[model samples]
Target: MNKRGKVVRDTNAGTGLISIDGQQFPFELEGMWKSDVAPCVNMVVEVDFGADGRVASVQVVPESQLAREQAEAAMRATKDKGAALGKEMVARFGAGTLAGMAALVCGWFVFNTITVQIAAGYSSGLSFWKVLGVLNSPLGFMNALGGAGGGSGAYGLFAVLALCGPLLPFFVRNPLAHLANLLPLLFIAAVCAIGYFGLMDGLKQAQGAALAFGGRQAAAMAAEMASGMMKEALRAVSFGLGAYLSVLASLYFAGRGAIKYLSSRA
Candidate 1:
C-alpha cells in the first residue's frame, strides 16, 4: 500500500503520525531513511505500507523545489504590488518627475536653513539674522564648527575640514548622504556641552564662596543654585533636541514624497 501525506511527530509521546486529507495514521519511521533525511514535523512524504498496514518505508519530499516555488511566488507578488502603487501615485501626483525633484530640493533647503539658524543661534547666542549671515558666508559654517578662542590658523584648519566634510558622503556608500547631515546634531551637542560646563563651573564657584562664608545656610543656598542651574540646562537641551528632530522629520517626509512621486513617473 502507498500513501502520500505530511509527517508529524509527537516527541513527548515518542510517536510518529502521518496526516493525509484530514485523516491521520500511526506510522513507525524507518531508521534507514533517517540517514538520508531527518524526520521533521510538517514535512510531506510518500509512505509505503506493509501488508500488516504499518508504514514500511518513507521518502521525504525535497524542500528545495518547494522553497524555490515560494520564492518565485513572493517575487511576483512584490512586483504586482509595486506596479499598483506606482500607478496610484502617478494618477494622483501626475507624471512630472522634474517638478517632484525640484520640490524635494526646495524642501531640503528650507529645512537645512532652519536647522542651521536654530543650532547656531542657540549655541552662540546670536540673533537669527547673524546666524543666517554666518551660514551664507563661505567661512561662516567653519566658525560655528567648534567653540570660540581659536587662532587664525585654527580657523583656517576648520574651514578646510568643513569644506572636506561634504565630500565624505561620496566616498562612503552606506547611509548618511553627507557629513552636513550631522551638523545640526553636532551643533546641538557643542551647545549643550558648553552650557553644562559653564553651569558646573558656576556652581563650583558658588559653592567655594559659600564655604568661605562658613555657614550651613550658605551651603544650602549653594545646593539650591546648583539644582536650579541643572534644571535650566536640561530644559535648554530638551528644547534644542526637540527642534532638531522636528526639522529632520519634515525633511524626511518631503524627501520621501518627492522620491515616491518621481518613481511613479518611471
Candidate 2:
C-alpha cells in the first residue's frame, strides 16, 4: 500500500526526495512528479507513491490541495506579469522619464497661467521669474505623482493598455490615426471627471480657508471666489467635452465619407 506525507528534504538528490513519513522510494523516470512538486520554505504536501525496487510514480495529492496549488500558481503568474511590465517600462521610458513628464506638465501649467494672467487684466509685464513662481504652485503635486512613475502595479496596467493601443490597428486599419482622432474626446472626459473632483476638493479647501481667515466678510469673499472658480472650471470642462465630441464625430464621419468616395472611384 502507498503512503503519503510532505517532502521534508530531497536527500536522494535527483532520484527522489524523502518524505517526512520515512518512506524511501524512487519516483517515475519520466519526472511527472517533479513537475508537480513545489518547493517553498515549509510548504506542506501530501505525497503518494508505492515503494518497490522498480521506479514508481509519485503524486502529491489531497483533492483540496489542488485548489491551494492553483492559487499559488495564480500568484506566481501575477508576479511574473508585473515584473515583465516593470522591465518593459524601464526599457521604453528609461530612468529619466519621470523627470521628463514633470517638465512637460510644468511647462503646460506655466503656459496656461500666462494666458490666464493676460486675460485677467494683469499687465502683460509680469517677469518670467513671476510666471515661474506661479508655475511652482501646481508643480508640487504634479511632480510627486509623475515622479512616482506609475509603480509596478500601475506600470503593468499601462503596459497592457499600450500593447492593446498598438494592436488595435491589426483588427482596424489606421487605428493609430483613429485613436488620435478619438483621444480628444477621451481627454475631455478625463478632464471633466478631474474638474468635478477638483471642485469638491476646492470647496472643502475654501471652507477651511474661510475658517482660517475668520470674519464673516472675509469668509464670504473666499467662498464666493471658490464658487466662481468652480463654476468656471466646470463650464470650461463641459464646453471642451462638447467640442471634442463634435470634432470626433465630424472626423469619424469624414473618414467614412473618404472611404466611400475611394470605393466608388475603384
Candidate 3:
C-alpha cells in the first residue's frame, strides 16, 4: 500500500514517522530516497508498505512546498560556499590585501599613462624632451589640476583622466567589481588614439613639410623627416602597447580581488 503523508523523525528514538491526515504511522525509511528526502520537513511524501506491513520506501511528492524547500536548500548551500571562500581568502591574503593591491595598481596605471603620453607627445613634435621629462615626473600629475588652454594643456588633462580611470573605480566599491570587463575596451581605445594621433598625424605633417620645401633638397629633407617620424611612431606604438597591457593585467587581478572581498562582505 502507498499512502501520501508528511515525514516526522523521532529525535529521541531515532526513527521515522509519517503523519497523514489526523493519524500518525511509524515507518522505517528505506533506500537512498531516505537521505534525499530527509530535510524536507512537512513536505508531502509517498510511503510504500511491503507485504509484511513494514515501510519499504519513502519518496517526496513533487509540489510547491517541495520546490520551495529545495530552492531554500540551494540558497543555503551557495551562501555556505561563499562564506567558506571568503574565510579562506582572509586567512591567506588577509583583509587589507585587496585595498593595498588596488592602490599599487592605481599608482602603476598612472605612471604608465604618463610615460606613454610623454613618448607619444615627443613623437608628434608637440613637446620637447625637457617638457616630456617634467611631464613624466611625479609633479606632472599636478597638471591634472590645471586648465586645458593649449595643446599641451589638453594632453595634460588627458593624462589626468587616464590616471583617474583605474583609481576612481576603487573609490566606488560597487563598480570595482566590473573593472575587468571594461579594461579590454579601454586598452583598444588607447591603442587606436596612439596610432592615429601619435603616428599617422606625425607622418602627415612630415609629408606637408616635404611639399613646402621644393626641388631635390625638399625631397631629401622630406625623406629624412618621414624616416624620423616612422621611427618615433614605432617607439610610441611600443610604449602605448606596453602601458595598456600592464594596466589591463593589473586591473584584471585587482578586479578579481575586489570581487572576492565584496562577496565575502556581502
- Best candidate according to lDDT: 3
What ranking of all candidate models by TM-score puts the best one first?
3, 1, 2
- Cα displacement (angstroms), candidate 1, residue 4, comes to 96
Write one digit per residue (lDDT tens) for candidate 2, span 152-235: 243234323432332242256542333432332343344346546755886877777787878678778888888888677444
Q: Each candidate's lDDT (Cα)?
A: 0.53, 0.44, 0.54
TM-scores of all models? 0.28, 0.27, 0.31
Cα displacement (Å) at residue 204, model 3: 1.5
Model 3 C-alpha lDDT versus the unseen true structure: 0.54
Q: What is residue 192's positional error in candidate 1, in angstroms?
A: 1.5
Assess the local accuracy of residue 119 in candidate 1 as a C-alpha lDDT between 0 and 100.
56
Using TM-score as the measure, the top candidate is: 3
Q: List the residue pairs that clash in candidate 2.
A: none
Candidate 1, clashing residue pairs? Answer: none
The count of residue-pair clashes in candidate 1 stands at: 0
Q: Count the backbone clashes (under 3 Å) in each candidate.
A: 0, 0, 0
- In model 1, how large is the Cα lDDT of residue 47? 79
RMSD of 1: 18.5
Give the per-residue lDDT of model 3 (tens digit) for 1-266.
98878876642465667787777767554452554535355767887778987667777777787789899999999999999998986776556544444443443333333232244244222122113233335255235323211233443455445434444444565644435434433533554465456556656666677777785688678878788867774555334333444455556645665675577567
